[model samples]
Target: MFKNVLSENIWGRVVSEKEPVFEEINKIVESNSKLISKLNNEYHDHDSTIKLLSEITGQKVDDSVGVNLPLYSDFGKHLSIGKSVFINSNVMFTDLGGITLEDHVLIGPRVNLLSVNHPTNPEQRRGLIVSPITIKKNAWIGAAATVLPGVTIGENAIVGANAVVTKDVPANTVVTGSPAKVVKTI
Candidate 1:
């Protein structure tokens, strides 16, 4: 499967015996919003903002500006977004591996779509798990919520606010709680 192959190829090179630093790959990977004050300017259009971000992260971003607010992702190099997706403020997407979001998705505030995680084995703690986060078409990830690695959020699913999703959310259902459960099926 491409997922496994992709993960193994990319994340295998991410971690080291010491902690991995973004600066180590700064030239290879893009992102310096903290260093460049202008990139953070609100005046930059969403498309332009994302474009600059792509240059910084070395990722490919398709169809930015689904909403007026600026979208931020470390995976601008690895993320491939779809059309008409309205994402709200303060979304932190760390796509060190890859993050693919399908069309017509709605994202709320402070939503974290992270793809990189460390292994449980302390002996092999240097190893990395780069699982791409896939939000299928028409999915809604709620506010201040966290979607863990390798979990596929199904099409048209509605994840409630502040939910911590540790598993795959089936399509057309509503999920909530710390380790989100199926609250309702829509």
Candidate 2:
């Protein structure tokens, strides 16, 4: 069950009365631009901040957590991660649905770690669908990859670049192509 913050929920809602709520949501993200940009400055000293974020997520990022990118989060729920994980640039996650990345995971650039999936029902889809996403330890998701909702990326799996993973990827396997399929077992 997800209890999204009011402003964060607006992105999932579109109603006349809720328009202001959505606007406020945008404002919160907008006002954080300076902080966001500064956060993206790879040259800045961010060990403390990154560690803080990892702590907030209930994840262990080990001693090497360095990268300059816009880290987005909602719900402020605890995200669990393992050690020696590398998260690259242009990574966007709506944790209103919760996201967990495990140890030794290598996430390439522009990887969209989505937690929400649209419902099959048209009306429900139009409203909103929320679910969590988990990437187990040693999972290497390639660049420009899009991982769908509620899917568990198994440990020691390799998801190829530009792949759209709509289902679970088995551990110790390599997968590519849209709606990724297993290429071979590692």
Candidate 3:
């Protein structure tokens, strides 16, 4: 099903407020829920966790890629994670739009990578706005960070703990605080 729906423009096409894309999102989420359930269940064997993660992402993950338990995502099919990525516990990906984590990226605990937003208009607030999130090679997102829709974490950039990222982060910089601002260049 994921292979069938995966197209270059399919994600972009699903953004219309009037469309039934939300229903599609629910279907995808429902299909993937079993996998995530197994992942989080104590009864399941731990050895096959990586295989489950690969299935959820719809991509082959490197042997070096490591993710802690209890990872969460609403839509996992649209996620693209690269080699040697390390994602800690309690990471949530609202991947209705898409999420790309490039090689060697490190995601800290309790981080939220949100790819969906709502319109400000009272009548339209329930409507979904979708956007892709990209974390470039070697980017590090610290604990409890919330990365909003359409943002990019540049290569080797660091987002400090508890920061709220709302824009593109420049390469080789460190950002902290709400609506994260560049604090230093490393």
Best by lDDT: 3
What is the per-residue lDDT of model 3 for residues 1-186, given as tens digits with 9 covering 90 to 100? 123243334444335456565577677789899888878875544447778888887777667888888899888888888888899999999887789999999999999999888877778877777788999999999999999998999999999999999999999999999989999999
Candidate 1 lowest-lDDT run of ten: 1-10
Candidate order, TM-score descending: 3, 1, 2
Q: What is the C-alpha local distance difference test score of each model?
A: 0.71, 0.67, 0.84
Query: After aligning candidate 1 to the native by TM-score, how far in Å is the CA of 59 from where it should be?
Result: 6.6
RMSD of each: 4.1, 4.8, 2.8
lDDT of 2 by residue, 49-79 (tens): 5765544443445566554465655433424
Q: Extract clashing residue pairs from model 2.
A: 57-79, 59-81, 82-103
* Model 1: lDDT of residue 13: 52
User: How many angstroms is residue 67 displaced in model 2 relative to the true structure, after the best TM-score fit?
Assistant: 2.3
Stretches of candidate 2 exceeding 4 Å from the true structure: 1-38, 41-43, 48-63, 72-78, 120-122
Alpha carbon lDDT at 97, candidate 1: 63
TM-score of 3: 0.90
Q: Each prediction's TM-score against the native?
A: 0.77, 0.71, 0.90
